[model samples]
Target: MTTGAEPDHGFAWPDVLCAPVRSLPEHSRLWVALSGGLDSVLLLHLAAFCHRSRVDVHAIHVNHQLQPNANETEAFCRTQCAALGIPLVVRRVSVNIGQAGGNLGGVEEAAREARYAVFEEILGPGDLLLLAHHADDQVETVLFRLIRGSGVAGLAGMPRARPLAAGQLVRPLLELERAELEHWAREAGIEWVEDPSNADQGYDRNYLRHTIIPGLKARWPGLARRVRHSAGACADSEFLNERLAERQWTECSKGSRALSVPALQALTVVEQKNLVRWWARKRGFRPPVVSDWSQVMHDLLEAAEDREPELREEGFRLRRFQGWIHLVPEQPEVPVSPVTLLPGEPLHWAYWTLTLESVANPESPSRPIRVSTRQGGERVRFRPEGSSKSLKNWFQEQAVPPWERACLPLVFAGSGDAGELIAIGDLWCSEQYSGGAPAAGWRLVVRRECD
Candidate 1:
């Protein structure tokens, strides 16, 4: 709660405490993430006093099970929420602070993902996930992201409001300094539990909060205020760029997953990057190291269209073929072992849900079979008179971009000692396997969500 030089000229805090949230929907529910820290504690306590007719108020505490006093902290939050008369949902989550992105920088981010997963899970339509992030928090976030080399959107820092799973996540206290919240809390005699990890300077955020921000403020007073304003400007610029990129994407997309390379080359480099960033963010891809994604865009634009050059990160892959930049999830190296599908067991593959519906193909094999990806030169015939065509050639004829060809699940059926391709995801099946008869082949519904 660094206040700089300003004295707490706080009025009866609730009147101003809820001003930032006045714009919330009239028929929405507001759930506060009460972390038992001073900032979150004060935020939950203050938000309880708001008029609940417009938006109902509730509290949630995610027990990360990380600290020595985690149980005690949960107890403290329960007492506080009970006193405040708000129904509290205590969610216990296991945090695996494993390597995020391509390496080991996801310690803090993993915790955030765990916390927000609970937040999003509980939210219904038109709900608000209110956080307790104050102005000082925003300042630290901006500085931290800056030091780590954030692009324009990262430099913009956390938004006051954004889409959270099925609802909206809003931080109403971004305009109020932490000092004001703490001052009002103390004046009103609010009790909060202190987190032990705040003292650990090993974490980048704690380092910035304890060792950097205070001195930065002392050297350049009102740095927090100026930084917040700069972030706002960046946010505005980002919004405009998104709108422009949407228009560019509408014209330039080859399909849901690829972009037209010729259309991208026609744009300025800045526009191209903006379009790519806009697309990446929409598809839930993390920000790649600057030059890596940049290089992908470069190769997409300048490389020969016939050459299938590709770039891949942990979760995603990018490729250029036939004047389109194709992006898809990176398929892990899977051994060509066929999964045994029983009648009762539900089959869940990577990013797909599978179900076997009774279709009319009398020639359908009853035995369990292999589910695999494209092995080159494999072919399938759609009709009795038609000759088998390569899977690659079929993909091109079907207007399926090259990037998606490798990951499409192919189902193989076996007879005695020989196996033949029977199904290609939910898209098609061989004429021998196609369903329409009274009681023949089972429809293999490989349910997947695509953009």
Candidate 2:
């Protein structure tokens, strides 16, 4: 109860327990990812006992509300932190189960996603978030990935430290065994809440932790260390893979969002797969998981030139256009109806931002300047008296992708069918609305944001 006033109780912790906590990366504020479990509780006390005076120590508890004793765990964390004179931040998150990877597995993953989301949002510059993952957890993660037919990167398990949001996430006890932490925790008389879900074997990780890992450990005494060694080897292989991908990415890319199809085709299938995954990750999107890369790569690189082949992922897609593979972000929904453009007020249509500014003085548009998607049969006149060209023919002349043609914002100077196309989504603008001096005394400025 209340950890009996203070931790340690005059019991000296060995150097093995104090070393990891004492040595940490440079950080102005230290944060413990407290779950009110044995590992996190011990981590909290270790942080307080070792480096509380050197840095500002705090704790954050994410209550997923998945367990029956969620509130009890949160209270326990608060009590422990309060007793140690450390500030605690508690966040209650709602985990949606049926989104992706449905079922109990989904719940487990969703809860983890929710917890990390909170951690990422809370951490700021000069801050470090410490997690309590240990060697036993590492063993479980490796075995789980291996059983799931993961690649080298997945088999590598979690890193000891990685960047999170604006801060860093460090697992100081990753090299220590769980049993060692439990023994020290008991010796220090530290109190923690028991999560009921940990005992339930319905979850994959819980099943592995309770049923499989114990037997493996009993059969091989150094199972944790051995698995950790294998994970390190996989990590090394993953690093080399990333290096090769980086080199190939540089060769294939032409300093644009798109890559040359011929250059990609020159690479081996494995090389192509690695490069594409690296590119997706570099752009902050998850790589598409295809069961058969040979078919996908053939479609992407060797498909008929006229037929546009595309691979769609969660946040982005790769579409081949005119001998080049373009990485396009999922388009945002534009206005259903035409949006009127006002002077000095910027109109954000999907990825493009438009502003109609007066060259000499602030003034409104002479006619209703509206922004809308293509309605077909629209024509654009390059000159005031020149021959008008169909929008379809103009898009073809410019070699715009078919998928992007429908979503590009079409800005018109007037309303109804008679509206003259003033701008084509930052691609082209009528002479009257462009240049340093405009005939209409106002300039339509359009800018496109990187997708």
Candidate 3:
């Protein structure tokens, strides 16, 4: 029953839409994510009216069948798009909102995942996915992240534009108020479906939107706008942090992949912690809490040089060997025995596998190579001209940690009585079995690090 003439409200929808899309490249295929809601309806109408030819406005509605009238909602969206002379794509998805632990967050996250999956599948490269997120939603997100003690990245709320699989997603209405969108819809005589669950306080976002945000806004009329500003500031700080982290990573590491432990140890404790945290986030690992990070830095950098150091957090373990740190999965001590490999058979291990292939070379020495687990006492003669040295001494000289030594695959040559250690992969390779004359083809292929 709302009317456009109710009040001026000092805002206009046409201006809102034009402002964001003004800078967008002309003739861009814009896909508007329509939820059969007022905001999306207004967005579709405005885009169709303004840039019908230059911008190909397509509507996509995801039917999350959580209500009895889900089919009706899809029909309404299709009709609306048809009326606007735009193409409509309706997708039906079933959301499993169960009553298990983490079910509340899980349901929302799963629905988001499902929606994005569909979007990626349908959207072509260079297309723009437009979302109807407004300033109010950004405010709520900032508050949610604040309650969870999130860092700057979380507090920054959603970005206006971010890269997805095939295309980029843009939240054009993020700078506008929700009330302005409603006013625009009323002026255009647009009809939209009402989702009853939005009013139901069972969901956390609904609870905040209905009960908490209104209360806060009542006391301070521009509370949402102020929080949005704070989010912008946080986003700026986060950007600076990322730039600094990139520079520090380059200066403190030898390769593009991992940091050198000695270089990391040279920095102050604060710098080291920042570098590690930045590295973890860049690698797609969840950022640790402040306390957890303190512990991780202490264990990783400050531990005795000879002592094996390990730090475990959320299925990931960071361990130090010599002057290098590696992130790996926490492995249990599963008993693995050496099994003879046939010509085409692959020897599987916890982390890697060894594949042996035979090549033709008459000059190649016929030596028997036996694969076996380390038994704590074994000598490997690396070269035919060098004296035989204990495996322990070789690992120490190579800077391999004591904990990782037992896990390395040890390859020995010579049968039963003449069996002698020959080569190892990713650890140390014996020189005795290394040299061979090349014929048409002669090579021993061993695949290591297979679980």
Which candidate leads in lDDT?
Answer: 2
Badly placed stretches (over 4 Å) of model 1 are: 1-13, 21-23, 26-28, 53-56, 97-107, 200-202, 215-222, 254-256, 292-296, 304-306, 332-379, 385-407, 411-423, 426-448
What residue runs in model 2 are displaced by over 4 Å at the alpha carbon? 1-9, 52-55, 98-102, 341-348, 353-369, 381-389, 413-422, 429-451
TM-score of each candidate? 0.80, 0.87, 0.72
The candidate with the higher lDDT, 1 or 2, is 2
Superposed on all Cα atoms, the candidates' RMSDs to the truth, in angstroms, are: 5.1, 3.3, 6.4
- Per residue, candidate 3 scores C-alpha lDDT tens digits across 368-436 of 455776877788766567788887887778766555566666766566546776556545554333336
Checking candidate 3 for backbone clashes, the offending pairs are 350-451, 351-449, 351-450, 352-449, 352-450, 353-447, 353-450, 354-447, 355-447, 382-431
lDDT of 2 by residue, 253-296 (tens): 87766788989999999999999998888888988899999999
Ranking by lDDT: 2, 1, 3
Considering only N, C-alpha and C atoms within 3 Å, which residue pairs clash in candidate 2?
none
Pairing residues by index, what is the TM-score of model 1?
0.80
- Give the clashing pairs for model 1: 360-440, 360-441, 361-440, 361-441, 362-440
Error of 1 at 95 (Å): 3.8
lDDT of every model, 2 decimals: 0.75, 0.88, 0.72
**Scored by Cα lDDT, where does model 2 land?**
0.88
RMSD of 2: 3.3
